[model samples]
Target: MQYKLITIEGNIGAGKTTLAKILSERLHGRLILESFEDNPFLPKFYKEPEKYSFPLELFFMAERFKQLQHSVNGPDLFHDTTISDYVFIKSLLFAKVTLAEDEYKLYKRLFHIINKQLPNPDILIYLHVPIQKLQKNIQTRDRSYEQSIPDEYLQKIQNTYLEYLKQSDQKVLFVEAENADFLTDSKHVDLILDALSKDYSPGKHYLQLS
Candidate 1:
């Protein structure tokens, strides 16, 4: 409640979108979900990461920047809070795992250029679920492209995300999600809200719902 903008991020199938939507509705905030459904390169990238990583990342970066620019800068007369399922940095994180060294360097430069122009979230909540749970969630979601995603790739992505969070200076609330399923339990959702309702400085914090 203290922050005007919050970002909920996690690995694929970690329930970020669902949590973001719930928060938006509960707080009467505007919700900005990442529009990746239309990305032509996504299915191909999943099928052939090495062949399509560069273009996929590039297209994603452009789209994320465009969406955030409009939504973050747009009017907020009707809402006091803005919540998004992703932060633009996600592009860079995924690129770190998917791109070659040279490609990552080029991508980093582009990321910074566009990133500085966007608003940073006041709080970043990262849901940390085990890879096994994440895999099950992915299958449950049943996106065809994602069906081919191997556990190794998911592990790599999880590592990259955790590494980024470990080094980031932004305010973050890392939630352990092995047992907490926000979609099914009201208590779990309340725990997340409790974390957000309190004050946190510019450092990493922890939340675990029992």
Candidate 2:
């Protein structure tokens, strides 16, 4: 199948961005990356989650909505190929883990409204990695705001991703990132593109990294 829109989703340090960039270049698709650096509430929420979770989630929800809207309005609409580093649905996964009960309720209401207006991706690539690998990657990347991310938080995010994939009807491609070197391996990149080209059946689609 030829997907006009492709979304890459994963927990922090799962290498979604790297794959998205490579795929976009390989496939000649436009790339839409999540604006994590510009998110003012992210660092604050990471530091004091209880106090800042609601605002942070809301901000992300709004931004993601706008980004999707822009994607729909762009020339990519006619180009037949686009890749994004973050999927809009992943917003709720983070919210579920980060927000308090009341905050989550409110976030859900807003999320439904925003989600109803956004365009769904023709294909979603979910990257999975072990908590230890995620921790190691985060440390190596040295993103200051991410330095304090707890193992439990990464675990929750990973679990939430799996649950979301199980319940979702969208065409999904699950990739295990434990040993994939997407940045340097052409064969690995080709394997991913081939997986995306295939039918979206349930279950993991393992691609050997050369």
Candidate 3:
């Protein structure tokens, strides 16, 4: 890989973490995973979105910033590459959907201040899975809080993610991953690796599983 830092991102249940973990191991790089499970407000946010959404997003913003700051700013040792499941901007993307207009304004201001200081990824890989596939994955994972998520809610988040990616300045490789099961098929991994190997400019580039 030409880049030292790579981030794999997607909407919920799009298998971003799985890909990041596999890539980190394959590349012998450092892995930085999100600690969403540690947030106390997550379960409540799912049960009562209006009541807990702000707190949930706030908690995630703080934690994500701290983790990225440490990982991105720290000295590199034996590992030459760093792979993360998320980008710090994810907080703003999710907040855009979850927060009310007034709340979103405040959140955006905070997000911009914190985001300017964080290190941007050299390569951003976005796994694009259709909503139906995402829902199936969520069901297969069987998380209690994720079980009741409505299609509308998931769609909103996915749309927000796509909108962000469209306007983002980072080198992006958008992969259409609806048909392939990467874990079971080594060929799928090879295909993604091939995409990542090529040099892309500072704009959105796309690759599809054939």
Global CA lDDT computed for model 1: 0.92
> Model 2 off-target regions past 4 Å?
201-210
Better of 2 and 3 by lDDT: 3
CA lDDT, every model vs. true structure:
0.92, 0.83, 0.90
What overall lDDT, based on C-alpha atoms, would model 2 receive against the true structure? 0.83
> Candidate 3, residues 3-45: lDDT per residue as tens digits?
8999999989999888888888888999999999999999999
Better of 2 and 3 by TM-score: 3
Worst 10 residues of 2 by lDDT: 201-210
RMSD per candidate (Å) reads 0.9, 1.8, 0.9
- Pick the winner on TM-score between candidates 1 and 2: 1
The reply for model 3, stretches above 4 Å from the true place, is: none
Rate residue 145 of model 1 by lDDT: 86
For candidate 3, the TM-score is 0.97
